[model samples]
Target chain A: MTAAADAPPTAALPKVRVDYLPMLLVPLLMLVALPLVGSVSTWVTLTVAALAMGMMIFLMASGLTLVFGLMDVLNFGHGVFISFGAYVSLIALGPLAGWVESDNLLLNIGVLLACILVAMLVTGGLGYAFERIVIRPVYGQHLKQILITMGGMIVAEQMIHVIWGASPIPLRLPEGLRGAIVIGDAAMEKYRVIAVVLGLTVFGIMHLVLNRTKIGLLIRAGVENAEMVEALGYRIRRLFVGVFVAGSALAGLGGVLWAFYRQTLTAGMGMEVNVLIFIVIIIGGLGSVGGCFIGALLVALVANYTGFLAPKLALGSSILLMVVILLWRPQGLYPVAKR
Target chain B: MLPNNPIHSLLSGDYPRSRVLGALLFVVLICLAFAPFLFPGSQPLNVAAKICVFIILVASYDLLLGYTGIVSFAHTMFYGIGGYGVAIAMYNFSPSWTALGVGVIVALVLAILLALLIGLFSLRVRAIFFAMITLAVASAFAILASQLNEITGGEDGRSYRIPEMLRPAFRLFDEPVMGVMINGRILTYYLIFFSALLLFLLALRVVNSPFGRVLQAIRENDFRAEALGYRVVVYRSIANCLSAGMATLAGVLMALWLRYTGPDTTLSFAIMIDILLMVVIGGMGTLYGAVLGAAIFILAQNYLQVLMGQFSGMLESAGIPLLPGLFHADRWLLWLGILFVLSVYFFPVGIVGKLRQMRK
Candidate 1:
């Protein structure tokens, strides 16, 4: 797998070939969409909106893909974490109403950061308990895992209704985050810009951590072959638990951003987004983070463009995209090796 | 092997295998058969009809999940198609027997075709992939149904008239039989009960046939089954189509009985979850479990809300904290969810499996 002969003699690094084909899909899709969109201003607005939505999705989906890659557990209840995160933010933001309404940008940002932090913490703890209780028993059995996790999802969703009163709660954006910035002819919401920035930062950190750190290396290796990593004397189980919790926390973070973007909250909102998330991960090739990011962007772009172009076909667009991609690539855009 | 009787032949030689289960099945059968006469109320009759419909739905699901070991979230999609088909046909055309026949045939054909396509496409992948793909497709279909307001009646769904024979105004006689009115509702109830019974027996026959053995073999180990030269994909796809067709029939019965076809009634994910719970709780891989599971679940769904309300009231008066909220009538599903998860972990064989195990 490694080209040792072509490697530089000085450092003796393995010459690994990275597949950049999937990486080019995001821009390629955008360029293809531009003509169909007709107007440059509308195209720019849709593209930015798509990017913001894609980032939020990536935040939620990255952890899920990682958990699946490292350990073959697809938690159907992952959406529960998203819903819980959003609700936690509701509770957290209740006391910070003043900060939310404040005229100062810093206070507004602070309130959001505080909400995100609280949500991440609460959902992360929930993830730990869920992993131990619900998922630990059916590790290798895919059927039971799907059933049990679905059961867990139903219970969690009902619990949210019991706690949240089964009504849609309205969430108002901060003073500074409201309104839009007009760039040329296109107008972009301030919150969308902030979301894009936050999503990018998170993605950047994940990229560095997964590529540069020892733990990242272990996770990658474990995803490829857990038994080999364990035979090498590493605690793959512990690593899996950590990844699961972190993935849930990321979902929570995404939930917070998604709630603010919508300015409303419902118990089923997480579930509503879950279909898109699954499509994203599948398109990206389950377990590949970079592929998931691109997949998210592709799905979001298609959704936005279709919603604007043909409102009726918007929902089916992503599924159509998945079908075409699967037919072409079979596994996904970037299939994980040995899976 | 020893006895050649009509009952055994009807059941396809698959007995209850446990006295308690056999007794339970008999009681359920009698109760459903005499529901209108014994209960003499609309509510009880409604619950019985619901049980009848669910028995078929859950049994068909067992054919895929329990027997073939395929976990699909698209079963309800086919069910919805059946409901919508009948609803739309009756809505558009005359409320005649031709409309009913046309609707049933169209729905059955559509359901089987869709099931085959999904099976052929996703069944080739891992079970997990199939599950996820079905979930995505089903959810998309739900959205489409809700969005297409003109045709589907949108979120409100369509409530249309059935044939004159099935409508409640039609009467068989001027007098009451055994203190029960001989109205069209009773006729409809009998129609559902007979159809459900026949369809359920057909499912049992399918699961007991040689084809059923191949499904079980594949479920146990696909590689070994493939080694034995049984085309695994073809068998699984056929199983998928069969299950989908049965579920569609159950939906058609439901639409006729309810006189309505709505997203909440037929296409909701909640119903899918309910089907899963019934299959797992009653017993997987056992056709008879569908009967018991559907009965228990429908009864709980109809009656447990009242019971939960009472418990919540008592807890509230006693000044308990979250206990009352947890036991509130709307939270009935929480208990079922917990029960379902526990059953999967502890009683993977479900009630039928457990009862038979006790007998052994």
Candidate 2:
């Protein structure tokens, strides 16, 4: 505050102060829903389920939001990476089915990690190729970018059919990861708990890396003003490519988790998830990860609660949430102040 | 020739050699109108009618994307609305011609209102934001349409009957005319032909009118257009409404043609992608390009699968196991997607724009 007050007139720098107001929407919503839900146990189960779901969504969305914020490119084909990740995880899981069926938690966890590693690597590599072959030509051209990326996604999805066959393949959860633990009359799925943990870990790591590291600073700076970062003699394009690759990897991670959560995978699964991902990103504000985290939670919680309360409105609830959010803050809940 | 005639046709003098291209198109359209008799089959007429419908659809898209420079993913929503409007009206009321007329009017009105609402709500946001908002809106509508099974028939979709006079079995003549049996299908095909042509002309008129130039100006430099005293938001909203209304008209025609309305054909995002591909492949900001793009794309979409099937059959016969499986007809989307990307990369201005550029 003193520095801001004492700052020279010519150097009126915008404060990087954290805004906590939007964060309150999450707790406020939870509190408001407690009475409507009535049963404490049901509310607990729903809340946990929503949190788990929100975490997975946040993991999926964080990458696209970063890419959009920093690179200012809308890659409508982002879903292909998610699909790639989910499909690639299957390859690792196929031979490891024995290990996955094991009663030993260590072996099951090991197989899952290996699958994640392989999925992330494959998707990250594909993301590199996607950028070079599809995205590179249409830089600064949003319309072309959208059309061509969609084309790329269509081709990729078809390729999935060519490889995986045109059928929805079911995936089995690891033996140890099955079933739920009851706490004080509230039942929480074991996998949901795992998901919540993994989601938080991802969020923490992302928040730390984005705020604490040199690359993170550059990314933040780039998001604010790429031209200035370029003028400062840094190769911002390489950083952007790295960001795109990272974003793709995150999407892949989310995909593997999502596949297990649903226990199924299909060629068009990514496209279906694409709609929800965009909704989350929009409600969170296009470029802000914190906003994305909160937005994801709000959307997921609302969806689960609404689904439980009024089954008919389940699908439309998230959309209604977005509309209400946009109505209140057209730019989003945590819109980055500038380009 | 008067070089500066104000009453020139829409494409006239817009590009070098455009008048010749326009004349060629007129001839092609005339030939297409008589295609059923000439070809002596419904297949030719069906394909031509489809092309005509898409020409109008793609042209209306060009108005939004090409002229106004807005990339809306919600065009299919309006298209679906138009389809559902007609389908529901006919399903609930009598399938009389008057009901069809009422359906068209209601669809158009509904489309305009929805477009206005969407435009006013999201138009203030940045370009990408608007796209995202529309995407959200479109997906929501699709789910709503599917979930509202009573009205939409859920995933199975709803089929409605057309007027008896327009049915394929309806006889127009008791005797053959010039060795050709005239039936209701032929009449309906011609109806599609003329309506599509009229709609295309109307689209051309809108794009050629001074109002369209303002849209172009907005596309180029919106702030500058506003500085020059144009109400940018109002014009944009009107463009949205016009584009939506036009799409709705196409939807109605499609419903009448197919006698069906459903989530898959009407509200699916896949259809939205198809429209985007048509507009982009045709050329942005060039009205004539829409016709060319739609014709080529629809032809390819219909025929490419057959071609792939034949190729795959040969490969299988030749004992190429893995390759044959990969080259099935159902995988046509893979090829279409690749072609879409290549078109954007190689022919960014689209076919007409490329020709115009070459002529210049």
Candidate 3:
């Protein structure tokens, strides 16, 4: 009895068996794709590209899914945050033009870091305002939220045009980040490798924070049963606001990465990728972050492969993938338990 | 009790309910009925014709978004199909009355079938899911239209010759009537007007029917409607199909009027937004709101740019930084977007709803 009492209460908790089935999907898809794609080097190149693209998409979608899960708000204007982030980076990087143009890898990295930090801060603040002004009144009403957020998107996109001018601004990659790094017969872009690393780091941090921290625990609990969490005397509203702001900031960060990848900044860039994001989130299940991650990878991989195999069918491939996945699991790949 | 007259029956007993709204509808009807004679210029007539076409389009959309509580982004896709159907037929075949007939019938069938498929596939899911799916499908359709250059003529789109009776060169009379030339253009305008009126009336009839009541019930509470033994999906799908059919007709009218069909004119997302603005601003759930909203929105779209340009100049002269640019004619959508948000918040019922409420 003394030994049992000495053990922590957590020791008595049942183990949460992680669902490994969904986790195998990424490698499974890659393996299936490898056979279909005959040339090894081209396949490797495509895989790396797909991974980088998937990471960018994951960065954009994770926040949206969490927001939907915790608050039941499908912000149609989520793409605006990405545009805002990218535009903010444009301004932030302007003063550090020397660092951007420099050959030194450390200087280039520093410039990128500073640009990302500023974008996150500005977009985070903007998100707070957006949640307060645009989203607060429409809380608990999904229809109005979708309509109002869409209006917000239209206004924000126009504002971007007004501020940056309508013409597309060319964004040059930093000297150290440009070009490709050869891995055997295959070559991967330097920026893409960095993007993969950054994406993995973000995912790791998110996983750790969500599983280990008290705030993260509260957020997870809130997602499952918001009223129950509130009944337990926790301020779920404040937690939601925090999540909203953080989601916006993450979207902004993703936007910066996406802009660098394209190297062209258009006002509609955010909106153009919006359809893909919607597809990703829907396929991942509306409210699950891990599902969103896998969904993004699946979509990017299918898109890249099909783009190589049959360019005409590339755009339709993702939609087809969504249809197939939905048929398999109507609630999405990893349906949130609440729904 | 109201008189059992044809006009009353035609209106389906769903009157505007407000004296002011009735008067406004009457005025719009009169303006559209005699648009060519009343408006002497080509631009005003063009605006009038556009108003007529959009009234039908917007009203049909109201059936889904307002009455059924379904938001679909693929409405424009069906509209494009109708336009392309007519455009392609007329392009391939000789400019004949049969060509027009064949084109319209084929388009109506295609639009209805596509709508049915979309409804069956997506209406089973949540409204948000349906909206996103429609959006994806619509964008894909637009891309497909553009990519299939030989059929759709790619980005520039296909411009085909209409029948002789509708061409601008064909005159009804040698002499000018009431200072207006009696040409095919005027005939075409009249064709559009009469068809719009008939279609609008048909829509009104449908909405006031028992089926429409079921849709409204479903819109109010789907679960309750289901509990009450109404097949909610069936009603929604039917509403979707009917709305698509009407939108397709409106597209046919537009194609006939323009003599050209392009992705920009028929299927652009901007036009979809415009439709939404008209629905919200005019008043959702009320068909009459579509009439007012479409007319007002189109008028503003045409004339407001000039007003905005002057406002921008005034702001520039005032040395107000950013105000000038914000008020630029090209940025009219920004103002409209703000209005849309405000309207959704403050006037969820919209202009017609407000007017009717005032009367009550």
Find the candidate with the highest DockQ and give its number: 1
Q: Give the range of the ten consecutive residues with the poorest summed lDDT in model 1 chain B.
A: B1-10
What's the best-to-worst order under TM-score?
1, 3, 2
Candidate 1 residue-wise lDDT, A72-140, digit = tens = 999888899999999999777988999998999999999999999999999999999999999999999
Quick one: best lDDT, which candidate? 1
Candidate 2's error at B246, in angstroms?
0.6
Please give, for residues B257-337, the per-residue lDDT of candidate 3 as tens digits.
Answer: 999999999999889889999999999999999999999999999999999999999999999999998999999999999
TM-score of every model versus the real structure? 0.98, 0.95, 0.97
DockQ for each model: 0.86, 0.74, 0.77
DockQ of 1: 0.86
- Which pairs clash in the backbone of model 2? none
Local distance difference test, candidate 1: 0.94
Q: List candidate 3 segments past 4 Å from native.
A: A1-11, B1-3
- In model 3, the fraction of reference contacts reproduced equals 0.68
Which structure among the candidates has the greatest TM-score?
A: 1
How big is the positional error of residue A333 in model 3, measured in Å on the Cα after superposition? Answer: 0.2
The iRMS of the candidates, in order, is: 0.8, 1.2, 0.8
Ranking by DockQ: 1, 3, 2
> Residue B293 in candidate 2 has what lDDT?
80
The segments of candidate 2 whose C-alpha lies over 4 angstroms from its true place after superposition are: A1-16, B1-27
